[model samples]
Target: MMHEPIKGNPLPSRAQAYKTVAVIGAGSWGTALAATLARAGVSTRIWGRDESVIEEINAHHTSEKFLPDVTLPDNLMGVRELSGALAGAEAALIVVPSRSIRSVARQVAEYAPDGMPVAICAKGIEAETGYLMTQVAEEELGNRPVGCVSGPTFAREAALGHLTAATVAFTFSQADRLKPHESPAVRLAVSLSTESFRAYVSDDLVGVEIGGAVKNVIAIACGMMTGAGFAENTRAALITRGLDELKALAEALGGRRETVTGLSGVGDLTLTCSSTTSRNMALGMQLGQGIPRDNCFDGKPVVVEGEVNAKSVTDLARRLNVDMPICETVRAILHDGKGVGDGFAQLWARPIEAEPRAMDLSFDHPASDKDIATLAERIS
Candidate 1:
């Protein structure tokens, strides 16, 4: 039962133009966004590694298996091969899961032409390599104008026409045929609002990228608090204090404190920690509810970005001499089998003092500038 999306949101009168945008991968995030761009009438094409899924989307105009219930426009084209998708595409939105990014990049490098923009949309830390996804992007897609898209966004919400926000930051460029994308695709672009949904791009891509990964670990700790039935005051205290530990690690990794403050950092942290949707939080809750560790993720796509990131962040924290107790606690809970109550108690017994000495950078950068939101949040 697929029908047209009610068409309430005003269509972009910009002649519904997309020179050529190809989305890589056909997972929920990739599929949802492909539908969004197609609905916006962008000359959009999506590349899926799975041949069966590609056939379904191309023939049905709906990605029923992964993103059921959403209707894709007839204009949307699906291809089983990457070379076909990359041909003539102005931009390629890379949406493969974090772990698979490197392999996919190698594939992309084989055919990706020179000077095109690649938007790295999927999130996570590469457990094996420890390099952020963008780092791999650079290695695989050499010198091609690069930008990163991140923030507290889920595939389903953004797909359902819920007002959603994200950040897609890139360096200033000057080249013909690649005249910096005068505007971003309409489905999700950078804009600010104190209410509803908004996204803003930043030049502090490393900082923003690190913040997105590090916060997932703390969200797991917050989930543990929910499982413990701690008071609201306790949860708030955990989040703020956990953020300090997170900030220290972020600075050590060359990420600005302000980047951690915006959507990917504080914003994403709040969304994942406080909500039932977060698999990391949900895992913590189940552990609190006495579910056995082996039984937790059986036959499910339960990915706790923090679970893997805890190790990465912890390693980075130790390397840089930063203190991060909450993160360590999560590691202990998941790996050492330390009781959740013990972990929480250990956190509370620690010392309280004046805000620890932290690095300071000049504030007051124009949000109009790329690094504005990321910098402001860190310097606060």
Candidate 2:
């Protein structure tokens, strides 16, 4: 849900706002953001390692490699060097893959100005450390104000200048400590918002990030059902049940269940699960259609995050003793060599049970200090 307008100091005018914004990662998502920011009149620079992509974006104002046929704004610059992207930029958006977040953030720390606000646009749990994208950013960019942007956004649609709404959750812990308009979330939201792209601000950073990360795994399950030619009602039931699992896991991680129903959770889940545009869903669909697991990524260029996230999300759920059968099943199929058909059968074979009560989904014990500290740490 979009947040109510909070009373505080007014935001700076666009003319007075940050003039230039750096968007790290020139993939589809990153390119889309750079285009949006440039269209919004913010001089935007997108950084990537792809020589052809950089040339296309700079010479032709297009990212043909990722966002084919979409014309980018003339003001949007593409840079091959990290320093060229971050140098003198007021804010940065890290849109790299989940696994590369820590490395990208480390580079940003070395190049970006001190105290520059950075927004994490990646969605996945770190397979090695089980850290959210924002957590990885925070640890690496220690002095930077880290935030997260998530929702049901598709790179292609957004790049095409289609309407899009997203949640921007900041790291602020106390609403009473800072005025609403003065908050990091609000500032970043303003920096990214445009007429076509709307950003809703929230303080529930953990909830927002958790919702985005776990939903991809669920999307895979939904895709499998679709590939198997299941009925609409069956898919709907899976989505609803999958949401309960998401809520339980979020609550266990010191996040709110309500966030599960918000944009990052149900909203993202709906968009990802129902469409072939989502790489995760497409992967699941292929598996459901009897494609060999080993041949799934035969020619894919980019990483399908759900394949990696399935294991990480399930592992985290297990550590917290959270029941996430759907996600676990996905993890098994994707990682443990479990057949897709067998996985689906196991899910259906489970005994029917009563739907969980609201209280059942709620966290029984509050998040302890130790738990919070552990969450902050990166496992070696």
Candidate 3:
């Protein structure tokens, strides 16, 4: 296990200072990641579409909304123009909210050096395109090496250097497509065995991504439980049902079943649900406590992935015949005028069958009754 040595200069010699790692967006999470790279000795350059934020980092070294009180590293530079940040960067990490993925990807493609690896840390689907951020990355940044970063990291916590772990998703068919690069920080690096933080790499990009997108909706349900004063039993049910929906989606796309059980899967979901800090979960709790769903995120000013993804996921589940009971209920509560209590009542009233009926819609089989029965028995 080779660890990055501690000193005035860290990072391996072969691992040249992210020779300018560009991050699009200057929010709390974006700032935290940029700070991480800077601390890792990677001369990180952050792009702020808003000149004021760039000026703030350049002048004050603190973001009032995101990372206040902690001064940003002196090595960190924030550029007002997108091209300035992307011009010579070997790699770029997109940390803009999921809804803004396409716009930022296009900017990078237009501004960055040719074929740079644009790693996407924004986790969500394009509600209009029905495409994950990676899909948008391929379309927007043609020929760019694409990778994804996701896990149970909260912006403030990761910034404070609390231990955390995440899976890095790289796009390519062959295993060699996912190897270590002396430059550009390639290959998925994991700090496993640490109590607080770590990461694991996987080829199951599709499963890991879709689960990351959909889990927010489920996490909101858990938040509703906390806000509504529900018992732990209620919260456990949401987590269990949420995992079922995630595994079903993972199987639908070509992801290894085991992948959904890992960090980007069940691990991420549990973190978001059990805690009140997650914006998405917090949004749901507010809604359950009688706040308008719109008011739940009224002033946040960034796309909450769950706010955009829940409907998209529910639509996908319906078309694919995947029975995502909890997801469907959450969608209804948000959009269909169904009160949280009413939604729970409906879920509890549904005819109780074995749990396998929840996620085994193997799009491979016939949807007919006899075929369904056979598939059900086989899965059971």
Top candidate when judged by TM-score against the true structure: 2
Give the Cα error of residue 347 in candidate 2, in Å. Answer: 1.2
Per-residue lDDT of model 1, residues 219-292, tens digit only: 78877777766657866887788778767766776777887888877877777778767777788777766667
Output the number of the lDDT-best candidate: 2
Lowest-sum lDDT 10-residue window in model 2: 371-380
lDDT of 3 by residue, 256-357 (tens): 678788888888899989887788888878877777765666655645678767898888777677778888888888878777776765565555556786
Q: What TM-score number comes out for model 1?
A: 0.80
Q: Report the error of model 1 at residue 73, Å.
A: 3.4
Which sections of candidate 1 miss by over 4 Å? 1-18, 173-198, 297-301, 356-380
Q: TM-scores of the models, in the given order?
A: 0.80, 0.88, 0.84
RMSD of 1: 11.5
Point out where model 3 deviates above 4 Å: 1-17, 173-197, 294-302, 357-380
**Model 3: clashing residue pairs?**
163-196, 163-197, 164-196, 164-197, 164-198, 165-198
Task: Assess each prediction's global lDDT (C-alpha) against the native.
Answer: 0.70, 0.82, 0.74
Per-residue error for 333 in candidate 2, Å, reads 1.0
Question: Tens digit of lDDT per residue, candidate 2, span 232-320?
Answer: 88679888988888888888888877777899989998899888899888888888877776677675564788889899999888889
lDDT at 347 for candidate 2? 63
Q: For every model in order, what is the number of clashing pairs?
A: 5, 0, 6
